[model samples]
Target chain A: MSGLEGLYQQIILDHSKARHGDGPLEHAAAEHHEYNPTCGDELTMRIRLDDAGERIEELAWQGDGCSISMASASALVDLMAGRTLEEAGERIDAFRAMLRSQGAGEPDEELLEDAIAFHGVSKYVMRVKCAMLSWVALEACLTEARATRG
Target chain B: MEGMSSDTLGARRVADLRLDFPVFRDAGEHAPAYLDSAATSQRPARVLDAEREYLEHHLAPVHRGASAAVGRSTTLFEDARATVARFVGAGERELVWAENATDALNIVALGMADASAGLGGAEASRFALHPGDELVVVEAEHHANLIPWQRLAARTGAVLRPVRVDARGLWGPAELAAVLSPRTRVVAFAEVSNVTGFLAPVAELVALVRERSPEALVVLDACQSVPHRPSDLAASGVDFAAFSGHKMLGPNGIGGLYGRAELLDALPPARTGGSTITRVTLEHAEFLPAPHRFEAGTQPVSQVVALAEAARYLDELGMAEVARHESALAARMAEAVAELPGVRLIGPPPGEERAGLVSVVVDDVHAHDVGQYLDEAGVVVRVGHHCAQPLHRALGVTATTRASAHVYTTEDEVDRFIDALGGVRRFFGVAGAGEQTGVVA
Candidate 1:
């Protein structure tokens, strides 16, 4: 595939068009806003923790951005919906590492699922922020949720 | 071709002119259509050679030692100042070397701030701002022109009155006149808006400011205009103007700050150090005249020399011819982009006059995506708020994709841009019938 094809995979395009968990969630425990100043891409990520505050019960977002950012948000919802907060944090780290590796780090499909499509995004330094915007917002939301719980 | 008949001077053909720019020559057939000249222009071989020749042969401290090398360096530096000042239609003493256009503007604003704090004494009192005085600025101004005034206002208890732009991200003399008051201390605006490509009627606005607030100093952000169009700072009647070299086929790290001679002499120098002062005591020091007073530290002598070469290059090409070519390109780009469905041109409508740039918003596609698509097609452009966030916000879009031109830009490149943009909606499946499998509703 050409570099542009790799960056804009069909799966990523599909996910962007049919965004999952793409609205304001009611009774959210924590919400965080992330902005990419360079291109003006912005997102508001919301999450609800379970009663035990260990697992993510719900995850949703509302934002305007490119296909990479919107698709990353949708894929994040699919990957972290029912995962434990600890597992989600680990996944965020792995995804960030893969994106920053400049097409070197091999992403485990089992861990990343549809988000492995973003492996090609790692090669383009400018697009890494777009792919990571939602994940960063999710991390911040989780941090806020944990702080509130404490 | 409207102005083409009047002046046959300069390199009339862009194909022939492209040879002078080494980047285009080196890139050969695969060169991306460089449509981002509004951000920074490509340097010509003459400009590069001028800088290299100075640094390789005669590198010395300027305006310092009485050595032969120092004298030669100072002569070259001051000669460059003359060339650039003449290009902008100013006296050599009125132009001061600065880091860039932003730094040049900061010098003016900071100098005023210092004056407000009683720095330059009685002569500087003209610049001092009172508590309720107003500093008028256009809402569509780039952050470089807007933020300094904001900081100056914050420091001097001055009120910032923004002349709001319309939905198209443009403000006229009427908007400026409405915001002007008797208490207005400074009215800062751009000669040509970086985002909207709107060429301001500077003389008209200056006249309005003079009529409404006679004491107010008019500052022109000439970063866009001085590089692309014909400019005469003295004739425009602005008290001060700033422009950078990099955007005019010159080296980075050098720019010009043009001030009326008397005003420059009266305004206090914000930066004070080695070369600017005449005599220093333990407690106080007296500064030199206008240009020297503003120039504090060691200068970018090599860059200044190259900037002069760039000025000569443009002069050989004749600014009128350059402006005519770029304006044609802009109209072509705007008209073509307007024809494309779902694309909204941001500046003056087709058939109206604007600068040699076109900014557009593609429905349902972010400018980042548009830029990536254009990049893949080998059509370079500028995307994002372009450091004019308030203007973008006022236009009800976060960002817009801008395609700008210089003497080297071609019709084929503009066509490529239009072609690439036409496919953006379909590629993203936002327009026309396409695969709609995953849509939630």
Candidate 2:
């Protein structure tokens, strides 16, 4: 009923149209790749880190997908970049909860903007799988990045 | 809506009758108008009640047990066999129960495999296929018919030649007979095409096969046809016929193969286990006769009982009346769809030749989108290629929407479908009836 405006919003569409959240960061950093076969969404995500890999210097991602997933990746890249591991983990948990709508507490106010666009998907059960496939793939990529350091 | 006294066939066809099934009656919001009859048919109250009656009162193991339950069950089981055989115009002795229609068809295939493999003992000559021999089937065959013969040909080094349908979903007597020569050892086909509802002239084709190649064995996939029409398998000259209970208002996991007793005896069982064997030695096992030999495992008893009831329900309404009635309904449905702007009848035109259903492609709309939109309107039709990929490829379309009718189907339902179909293009913002929709979701 609301047309595509509410679903797309300004920030998400800009990110999708520009593909700004793309490519690996230059210099030493943690990197990951994601794949969602259901809707043909694929992303190679990269995050630059300080010497010890405890703090994020830059975060970027490249992928092709529907408007929602690509926008979420771009927003995540922008919001989580320059944040420490502890803060990034909290943010990730909050994003996952918002998508699930079942976690113990709400995510903080700042990083919740892009994630709100997807709440409409929960009503359509079939679309939920399509929307979550990318996020799950991103989590897998992040887990792989953390494992590589050990 | 049912019984002989009823003015019309109503929604009594095998697949359409499923809506009367209590299970389907539970579609609270969006009922699935199941058009996938070739896959299975839903059971109506008559068939279900028949099953319940048998289970509640006539419960027992048939053929061997001596208790009152056993006697009553055997009567019910034997009575089912007679009813199914009679429905297809075969003698009761000639009909043999298998697991399902696929199993029924496989019994023929494996037996042919055996004869081709020289496993039929003294009677092996009746079925043996040598190198350079031909096994003729049609391109419209479901994988159930195709794969088995393909495997059989592979095993025996025989050629599998198909009497293929053209772009319009039709294969006639002259075209089919053209492929039959001295080399053709067998001719197999469906009495009706599951995808297109293209009715084949079984009697004429089988007669040609007999004339052209006297030794050619004929097998019929009655899975689609039997549920919709009255089939006289023996009279049609096919040596064997297969039909499933699920497709004919019975339970799933059960079916039958009607074979002339002499022919059945010649065919060795494909599966061997407890019941089918007479005596077992360390060296070899002597198997029981046909039907039981082919059964091999504990048969689907409850389903078989249910199938027997389905046959009786069909009998209560005369088969000839059933056929004629559904023919009119199918024709009406097809004609209504054809009249819709830009609706392309994928199969034969109405009255050209058909069983009791139609498949069509609408211009400018993807079938999936069409199906989704129709679901909103509470009209359920089968979307996508109806499993005959080769046939669909031949017809030059990726998918088509099929709406089939049975006895329970009303003329009003047909009109509603046609009316809603006209709106499908406009609702989806599709341009025209002849224009194509590319990149379907």
Candidate 3:
């Protein structure tokens, strides 16, 4: 597949259209709002941590953005819904590293799952920001959620 | 270049002028069909070389020293100012140097803020606004024009009255008439809508402002119109106007603020320091008049020189021809793209007299995705709200993709853009690619 096809995989398009874990997390520990002024892509994410504050018990978000950003946000919730904060951080780092790699980094497909489709997006210097917008929000909200517990 | 229209004026001139720009020359196969000139124009060889020559030879501070080098540099700089002044139809003293068009508008707004606060004494009262007064601006204005007026209104106790735009993102003289009143202190607007390419009826608006609110000051954000057409700011009867150099084949970081001599002299200087003072004391200092007072600190001398060179180049080509070339190109582009399935043209309908720009919203495809698709097809365009969020909200689109043209634009480049835009919906799988939904003009 070409880079454009790889970037817009069937899974990404489906996730973008019918996003999972989207729209308002109730009794949430933390929430964050992020906007990309360049293209006006916006995302508001809410997190509900478990009683132990070790795992993200629930992750919900709402946003209006391009297919890349929407899909990335959807795939993020899918990857980290029940994972520990440390594991989520690792995944975020790996995703960021792959995006920064300029289409060169071999991301762990087992960890990234649907997000590995964005490896083609990494090739585009501009679209990397689109793919990473929600992940950045998640990182910030996660940090805030951890602080709220502490 | 099949389907290229032979009817457009200056089609041959565009072909000839294409060679002056270096970007088309260097990038052969990978050359982007540039259609984003309204955002920022690409400089020609003459403009670039002028700046290089100035930097290489005459690099000295203007208007400061007693040395011959300083005198020579000051002459070059002032000469540039004069050339630019003539280009925009203002007197030498009427024009002030600014960082860019945004800075120029800010100079006026901030200066007015100072005036409202009793800064320039009694002479500045002409600009002072009170709680009951209203600052008028149109919804379709670029943020460069709108935000400054908004801040001005906030700083003073004046109310902001926006003249509403239609669903097409256009406002007419009737809209302005509806908003005008005796309490209107300032009327600020763009001579051309950067996003929608609506050519504002300047003379009619000025006349209406004069008739209804005689005391109201008129400020024009001339960033779009000044570059593409022949403009006489003095004749237009606006109190102040701002436009950038880079949009007119000139160097960046240089722009002009044209204010009527009476208003400019009375208006308080927003930025102050060296080169602006007539007499200095520790507590109180007397300021120089108009352009000198506004131009604080060491100026962009090389940029000024290049900008003047750019103005001269444009003058040689004739602004009328440039305007005709770009308008025809935009009209052609509008007609071509408006026919595409699910594609919506944002400005005036095809064949309307617009100011060389075309903005569009594709159904079910975000503007970013459209821009990406165009980029992949080697067709560059501007994407986003284009710094006019309120207008975008009014138009019911979060963002739009704009394709604009300059003097150097060719029919082939516009064709490439139209063809690329035609394929966007199909590539994105937006549904009903071939099936027309009556979008054709």
Candidate 4:
């Protein structure tokens, strides 16, 4: 019930207007394109990592889609911006579980605050694809980042 | 659905033609009148019974076996073909059965692929496409007609050029003449446009093709026209035309591809595995001529038979009468919707030039929301870009809600549609009107 059902949610609308994931990356590894063909939503998620392998770095995403996909990408980048590879990986898995609602170890506390608003989204199953699209892209970017850094 | 002007067709109110469709009968009493016939017409008792009878009593593999049942089935199949031919004003020899109009059009485009690949001999000469050649189709063509030609042009390195329709979705003589150049080797069009209901002038367009791009064979997507109009395909001068049985109150899996005999003879087969060939060799194969060449495998015999029944049903009703019935309904629907607020009606708007369908955009509301709202009130209409994504893009919207009519559609259904649509703005809270008479102007 707590999903971003209303397209006019003030903070979400403001964040969408403010543009969260437009950062300039100094050094980036790989850029991945994710598209929700059914609804014509598309986004390219890019990740930047330093040589240390486990430390913080920059992330940027750009494209067009519905409010949910764009907002999810915005909130996802906010979380993954400075988190370490392992912590990001854990968060991505937890987010995936939360979206799918598997009865596993409870997702990390912070992701639940804004990110778990999407947890109620699975109840409206069709929109779950839109809600989880960015998280999947983030997961993909992390996997690619890990492969290159290792 | 249009509002009923007294429940009479020509004279008196009778055993409603609307009640013949079982869905309406089963849906309690007074269901939402299904006005979207161009999307797909509801099947009547005869078409349904014919389908069930064929499946129950006459099911058999077509054109291969020497068994008595097989022979009877093949006879039934070919008889169905003849029915479709007669319905479309074609000879039995010229019409080939396809899964649907999409499959029929794809068969033409894909057969061209086989031709370009140099498979069919002299027969494919007319279908050949080369670099810098042009494939001309109108922009308002349904995706079924537009995409295959696009893929064909891409495959052959030919330019897929479109003759444009303006903001009101009208195709003009001069615009079409400008596009039908010498380099244009194939021109595909819809007799009745799927979205806007803008009826393209086939004869005039064919005359232009003959005068300018003489070598360009004309392919007509008759999916919209054949169902609604009593057509004489042979007289139209189109080389290849496709139509679906389902849209005309027949079984879903059967459609007809009408080609002028020589065109069918020359067009290469898109799918070739069985039933098409007379003799199969390790290196070479000799295929059967015309209709059979395109029919690669076991035909949908039951659907074909039921389609014949469906054709007979329409024929019995008199296609001209059905056309008149639907035309009056479409005009009324347009008039009613035009009066409602925020409804910018698409296309030529209930004139002699329009087809049996109409699309509209409501100001400041999404088509899906409109569809959902209408569905709640027991009205059904297709929402979204309607597979003409580029057309909608040209119209500067992602989607529009479309409602179409057929013989079975009653005027009261159209009234229900208009009345229900008037309630959408309030449902979405986009406009503050409690009664939903939110005027766009």
Q: Best candidate, DockQ-wise?
A: 1
TM-score of each: 0.96, 0.74, 0.95, 0.83
* B399 Cα displacement, candidate 3 (Å): 0.6
Give all candidates' CA lDDT scores: 0.90, 0.70, 0.87, 0.77
- B38 Cα displacement, candidate 4 (Å): 3.6
lDDT of 4 by residue, B1-441 (tens): 344352444432423765677887677555765766777888988788988888888888888769999998889989888888998999988999899999999999998987887778776766787889999988878889999998998899999888887887668678888888889888888888888888778898889889999788899999999998889999999999999988999878889999999888888888987888988889888888988988887778888999999888888778877777767777876787778777789988654546667788887666755665576567778876777877777787767889888776776777788887776665444455544463211
Q: Which clashing pairs does model 3 show? A: none
Models ranked on lDDT: 1, 3, 4, 2
TM-score of the second chain in candidate 4: 0.94
C-alpha lDDT (0 to 100) for residue B334 of candidate 3: 84
Give the alpha carbon lDDT tens digit for every residue of B1-441 in model 3: 224452343435565566688887676645788889898999889899999998999999999869999999999999998999999999999999998899999999999999999999999988898887999999988888888888988888899999999999998889999999999988999999999999999999999999999989899999999999999999999999999999999988999999999889999999999999899988897899988998888899999999999999888888888787777788888888778778899989987888888999998889998888787777789999999999999999899999998987777787888877777776666667246432101
Among the numbered candidates, top lDDT falls to: 1
Please write out the lDDT profile of model 3 over residues A1-150, one tens digit for every residue.
255577777888888777887788799888889999988899998888888988999999998989889889999999999999899999999999989988785888988887888888888888889999899999998899778777
Ordering by DockQ: 1, 3, 4, 2
Candidate 2 is scored at a TM of 0.74
Runs of candidate 3 exceeding 4 Å displacement = B1-12, B433-441
lDDT of 2 by residue, B233-278 (tens): 7787788888888888788878889887788877887777777778
B292: Cα error in model 1, Å? 0.9
